[model samples]
Target chain A: MRIPLVASLAWQDYRNDAWLSACSVLALVAVIAPLLVLFGLKFGLVSSLTERLETDPATREIIPLGGGRFSSAFIEQLGQRPDVAFAIPRTRQIAATAQVGTLVLEMLPTAPGDPLLGGLPVPQGLEQIVLSHTAAEKLAARPGDWLETRFARQVAGRVEARDTRLQVLAVLPLEAFARDGLFAGLGLLEAAEDYRDGRAVLALGWDGEAAGVGEQRVYPAFRLYARGLNDVEPLRVFFARQNMLVSTQALSIAQVQSLSRNLSIVFWIIAGLALAGAFAAIFAGALAAVARKRRELSVLRLLGFSTGALLLFVVLQALYSAGFAAVFSAGLYGLAEAGLNQLFVQVPGEHASHLLAHHYGLALVAVLGVSAVAAACGGWRVARIQASEGIRDV
Target chain B: MLNLSAVHKSRGAGSQRYSLVIPALHLRAGEQVAIVGPSGCGKSTLLDLLALVLAPDQVGRFEFNQQDIAGLWRADQQSTLARLRSQHLGYVLQTGGLLGFLDVRGNIALSRQLLGLKDDGSVARLADQLEISDQLGKKPSALSVGQRQRVSCARALAHAPQLVLADEPTASLDPLNAERVMHALLAQAREHRAACVIATHDEPLARASGLQVRRIHCRRDSDGGVTATLGEAG
Candidate 1:
């Protein structure tokens, strides 16, 4: 009943019944390999999707609604909130146009770190502008190119305007925004305000007050971003409490979370069923092995092996088979992961394309647990063999 | 050394009862005894009882090596009996009872391995004595019937137990093989100063093997009960 003897006997028996032992190992592999691959894919894909969501500011974008002016201090206060990454005031200009000799283009005020800009730096002064690729092509301008343009605004049934020369600081790529518009700094808004008040020499003189005095300088709207997707809901609630309307992609994120949770549940259920089947197969195989070696086991009993020793012998056989199966399952998982990644190469977005090492470790532990239980069930039979049975069998 | 007196073992109840009774039996070191009986006799049953594999319903006295071991059959003494079996006794079954998975050398050395004893070249020496040296690396299934029987004998004597029990050790062998196996078994048992008890139906062979012969006789009574008794042969 010594461990060495049991091990030697178990190994010898394994070699003697190579086909049956191989069958048991294959059954374990059949259950473990696919389960590991599935888990690996799920983990990989979820991680990739999470990475994408984190990197894209749009997922955390918050747009404040209503067309009214708010003080610059209000925008600054909103930006200071812990949940807010950045908040920029936007003014809606009526008939705001830029004329470069014979070419005319619409101008929009933009802020630094705006998602629409695709990470392009914002223009820092009234002399600087960021042109869309299409707009730049139309104007025949590149970075550091000076262009002359005039801003016009209407008041009291008359047009008031001023001409300004601006330098193109950068051109937005197609991925940044496909639309044909010029992005300008707050300086442009100041120039527009000056023209609206008839302060420019080219404007028709009128007796109207300056637009940016006190509360009258409030912006029509503001673009806001959260530090992270998890902060979106809290920021939305805060904005709503202030009677301010906010827009975000929280609903899409929630939908994806729910789908991922459901998929995980389904995957575990299938894995559980597969493990149960594997347990049954391994248990049945152990039982069959016990029955086939009944005489041998009885002889061991007669040779002074205790029931515990016999049980150990049987358990050792099961562990051997499980060990082999786990190795094979790992190899098969590696191959399957490679094949799946290759198959999904053309798919867009972040793809979980490889099995993680920890997942493989977890699979090994699971297989060992399953095999141990099954082997114990089988070893119980060997433990029950009476020593006298050896003689009776003879 | 072994001793048994007024031991009783029975199977079934009432009308279907079959019982075996041994009034007294004794064996000393270096003694060889063979229980001879025809089929349907309790020869194997007696062997099992003496080997402590089958528990007797009651016993007046059961001693091994001058220690009263009759009470050792209690559940509490199970481990004690197992230890004794491993350290002090050996067994050979009728069909050789060799584990097919192990090679000849492994099979012969199993008892020594279980007892946690160093080999001391006993298995090799025994194999040489039994002319099974060439068969040591082969599995039992690869050996002939006679060769397998010799390996079983070598296994029984490997650990040098104080008592060796063999049930029909040569039941399936030809006359020549039967003589050769019995000769080797008895010679080894004597050389090791071990008491040996063999059960067989061949009375002539049992007597020729220089073993004190005892016969087991069974009779059915009118009430559908059977009784078995053991006594010395004439």
Candidate 2:
């Protein structure tokens, strides 16, 4: 009952004092709306893309870097790392030339000893090639065609690989390679290049395997794998430290999403500043109210109120106003966010959670802090009044 | 019971020193006293001393209800005096210090609430008697000066304090309103069997009320002393 008296009096004061409350609401809306939207979209996109990356394993090491070569020694070294689960050394090669019919054709050759190459129509005991759907269209070559491949370093020089021939075993799907085009085994090209250079006399060079030389091996790049997607970062970092050019497509995507969200945070900051200004105005307004009501506090003292009770009354009043304002602001923000979402499809999905996570607690803390500061400023004037001051003015 | 003997209060020290004195004044329970004075006299100061708001720099055996109040510690003194004031004394400041935010009814209710009085009927009855009942729903800002003064009286009497102190309650009112306020104040003080002390310069209003009156003269000799003229007129 006693508490209600104090609480009711405080509520009455807050309600009757409209201008300050309006200012406070305006400031709160300004700060909180943008913070919610910014934090919301940031969390939304980051989590969404992270979800997709975490789900797939094939795309984990499909890094587009260093002209598409998977080196064996690098794959061996990557497999030795604790985080790397499986490293596959695969090479891609592109040999573009003009055919006898004056038509341009691109050849993609594959390694000889790969397990996945067994079912293809490449001629038995001969190194074979898989052609892309588009590459197959221009080559005018079938599954059994003796595909003559040409290689030339300078246009003025003779076409040296005009005599090299192979069979196109399979027409691979168009989507087999990335949208940038071009896919093949780097080992086959190396073997073919060795033949043209007269290294075929070495006997071990044309087969795409050097047998047992460790230091003489070269690979375009290594396709590094991991136990889980999270394992990729440390593995990537390890290779990067070795001066290997590395890229984390997933991380980059996350960063872009975060950038978009961070941009919104600036708007939130402005809104927050507005709320602060409004709160400052609230403090000033409440202080003015208290100043005007000095005689009332003196009256309470005259009616046997303890100094503690007087102070309690003031603090209670402030807390009541601040608490009510916080609840009101949260509801207002929620409604606004919902309405805005309906109007704009680009409104990120996770915005509400982000807003609640970051700004809600902050607003609560700020409201209380501002309320307390206002109470202290206002209480200062009351503490100095002697009981006689009330009656003397009358 | 309230008692004061050789109470002294001074505004400043030595060269600028001025003292207020109330010599040998006593009031039993259920007694009303009117303090009348000219301007610059220490009537309000005497009331302040009695109210225990300002302590005398020096004292000669001043007591309140047989308690030696002269040597009480600040906390102990405030508590003791505040307890008495809450349950037994009502004060009406000269200018009707009604809180601006509260409506007339709420202002009247504040005294009872502050004093921890549980009764609502007493507050309502006082509001009716002070003629502030019709204005109860309106804030102090909506009321005229006279209406606010009436609301102040209603608040003072609402808690039924045993002692009521009115410092120039009629100072801001015209003759008719002053008479109305004085009559309401004196009538309520009698009904509650409370002792009421009013400090005022209005001689006719003080005389017409027909209560026991005391006149105070602040010493002009620069020592900050008040000379209490006892039982001046009744």
Candidate 3:
């Protein structure tokens, strides 16, 4: 007979044993629970880190220069490299204040079509300003409404022009729009710089740009979206060899992935220990069942039951316990994962990213592997039975 | 028929060897014999050897009905002995031989099952004859000594074995329970036309049963070997 069939019978006998049945079930659960938790943590960390890498351009770049001027000059050069798929130079600056009437808003400048600003709405023209939902509400500004962004320049010992305005282009999505919300295109930053300089600072300037202003230079950053994360390193090296100060935050990605990997290992280890306990319980249960049926087993031996038959019977019992436990654990783990996900919200557009982000492949492997081991342990005693002793005391 | 010639049994070896020597023994079909002896006479050891439950240290020409049983491999011997014992030999122990996990019926059914006897009526009829029909659902622990003994007798005789071995089957029972157990056992043995071997010091049972009685006496020989002398016991 198949060992699984025999294990099923043994499991039935174990169930009749009552106390042993409970113990075996407990062992199975112990093994499965930790594996599920570890799997969840691994997926969570990996997803969070990948989100940071792919969504934030600053983190993806190999080099970020200091200043409002971004050199699109290297964009054409970097794009020609065989290893690089897409590289786009972007003007990024931190504006301390965007004063609209009595309201002062935080200005974060970003690229117009960056993948990182996925959920936020960006405008196509200079007349439009994409206000954060909070900023829109604070300024009482509508999509078509015009808003002024004033900047004060400190040149020499004097304050220059302090006022400027940009049309409120569009209102961003209310959900997570304020979470590091970006104002795309360099026009807004340019307008703010113009307000500081008093004299118009547009296009390239040679002399008398501002009282304290020196020669113009470009402060630049670029987003390099390669086909794979492995491609990120070669590009980093290429940029470094060119005498450029390159900084790729791929280490952050590695840190997240590593944390996820470590957490999974820890979870599986803990889960494995619990599973071992469960397996022991199942083994003990099988032993007790055999002990209870000592006379029956003896009788079977007398009836020409080969030791193989007895082994089959025991194996069947274990399979039965494990099979049931597998189904139960899977269902329970699913329900728990769903409930946990519902209870914890990471972000709104967090779903539609990559293929491997939230998958519980590791967890599945852990649960099944542990369960199989546990079941095998339960059947060990049945296979090792001494025919003489099993049959009778004589 | 069973035969044993120059059967030498011992535990351990060399200076520690505790040997029991039974020169020759034979039992024809339908002959009930009792092995009566003092304590530590190796009566149980002889029974164990005869039952083929344990192998002796040495034996010359050991056979059952002309079939040589000596020198059979342990694995083959175990299966062969199990079949022979299940079908032809019954053992009745003193401390409630019926398993505690099994009810009276299960205990009885177990023997028939072992013997590959599937007839429920035969089992039911035997249980009725043993006077344990009403207590078939009760475990050995739940039954009185006399009832438990009767259940054991039922199980032992369920498949109608050729020889029934009783190892002090009544030693733990009261006089009445012991007599009842013996009477039930002997009656079943007779019904099956089987030989009964009762290894016990119960003289009352020995005398009243009217079965052939053989006494085994153990004494240390000059060489320090324990010699078991077998003879007719009054």
> Which candidate wins on DockQ?
1
Ranking by DockQ: 1, 2, 3
True contacts kept of each: 0.67, 0.69, 0.10
Model 1 root mean square deviation, Cα atoms: 4.5
- Sorting all predicted structures by TM-score, with the top scorer first, yields 1, 2, 3
Candidate 2, which segments miss by more than 4 Å at Cα? Answer: A1-3, A27-231, A238-247, A250-283, A306-332, A335-354, A390-394, B12-17, B65-84, B129-133, B141-150, B174-177, B203-210, B222-234
Model 3: per-residue Cα lDDT over B43-131, one tens digit each: 77777777666677788768875656676533456556655666677776555555565567877776666545577686788878878
Across A244-342, the per-residue lDDT of candidate 3 in tens digits comes to 666677687677667767876886688667766765666666566666666556545433344566756655555555656656666676676666666
Candidate 2 reaches a DockQ of 0.42
lDDT of 2 by residue, A202-316 (tens): 3222322234545454555544546566676666677677666676654754464566567567656765676567557656655775676677777767666666566656666
Across residues B1-234, which tens digit of lDDT does each residue of candidate 1 receive? 688899999988777988998988988888888888887678888887877777888999899876567788855465677778878888878888898878999999988988888889999999999999999999888889999999999999999999999889899899999999999999999999999999998989989888899888888877788898998655
lDDT score for residue B105 of model 2: 80
DockQ of each: 0.58, 0.42, 0.10
Model 1, residue A232: C-alpha shift (Å): 3.3
Give the distance in Å from residue A362's predicted Cα in candidate 1 to where it truly belongs.
Answer: 2.4
- Candidate 2 steric clashes: 17
Q: What is the lDDT of residue B172 in candidate 2?
A: 85
